[model samples]
Target: MSAPTLYELDPADSGIYRAQMVTLTDKNPYAASVYVYDEDEYRTMRLLVTDDGKAGVALKGDEIVSVFAHKDCAHPKSVQSMLSQATALGGRRLDCFDTVLPDLYADAGFVPVARLRWNDDYAPDGWDYETFRTYNGGRPDVVFMAYDPDRVGGDYTPGVGEYVEDYDDGIARAQRYRPS
Candidate 1:
């Protein structure tokens, strides 16, 4: 097969991406949110999109290598593409949270960061853990790999807040991940 092409999606493309996210969530119930941001916002925040068009938030600081991609696009190339973009943008640390895509991220250089488990405490009302655990029995683990923007080697760093915003407690709880 030919190599898949990567494109930076426009905001107007949210409908298609959101639909894909829904499909992913159906397959992995622990997924509570799948967000996509416009290029302007993405750039301002140092985020990136993968070849399959999954959005990622870029985390910079303490070596500058962290990204959060939506839990779809279980392809290694997609993670690599995001890493490439992050590197091009001068980032050094890369992170993603898709257990299905860990191998891909690993091959590209990300190591397992932490295993994430969710319950009703992290979900909204009407959400069901039994259903979620059934859907994603293994649950998803956070994976991270370090990249050096100044050099040509990949390193690993732990404990950096890549996806934390001071939203309401409920909102914060919903978006919480290992702060590294």
Candidate 2:
């Protein structure tokens, strides 16, 4: 089999692509609808379509901020292709919360700078990371990663660590902590 083609959908045909995405993929309805209704956001959407699957991504400036795909279409190749296209188009950072894609992102040269887990008690004042629930009402831990390792710092290195609850404090500690 061949790799699916990933491309930017024409703004004029967003509605058509939106419908196809909804019916053909198991993407989150609420997330996919944003592109369908928001004209400006639709311009940043990238889509992957093949005989057997579909995938979508929404870019926030140079960051590939959101991604949704049909279950069958979320293969490594499709996701990798999307990352390659993002890099070619100047994507520099991404925060991956999904359990599966973080590995793929790491393989694409994005280094994990911090890992976050929700803890209402330890969370900082006015912290809303836990409040932004997914469509299924779950808050998966977020992994803050950067495509350019230099963006974090010269001393920062990639290594596994325990999940941190306080976003600000966690990031500061994570940057200084190196796993054994």
Q: After superposition, how far is residue 173 of candidate 1 from its true place, in Å?
A: 20
For model 2, what is the error of residue 58's alpha carbon versus the real structure, in angstroms, after optimal superposition? 3.0
TM-score of each: 0.40, 0.52
Q: Which parts of model 1 are misplaced by more than 4 Å?
A: 1-43, 46-79, 94-98, 114-119, 124-180
Model 1 residue 62 CA deviation (Å) reads 8.6
After superposition on all C-alphas, the RMSD of every candidate to the true structure, in Å, is 8.3, 8.4
* Superposed Cα deviation of residue 21, candidate 2 (Å): 5.9
Q: List the residue pairs that clash in candidate 2.
A: none
Which digits, one per residue and each the tens of the lDDT, describe model 2 over residues 1-180? 224566666666556556654464344423322223254455555543443436655556656644555656645446656665676676666665534456767766666766776444543333334344541134455666667533322222334435665666444553443323
| lDDT tens digits, residue span 63-121, model 1 | 23223445444454354665555556555444444434444444444443333433334
Report the Cα lDDT for candidate 2.
0.52
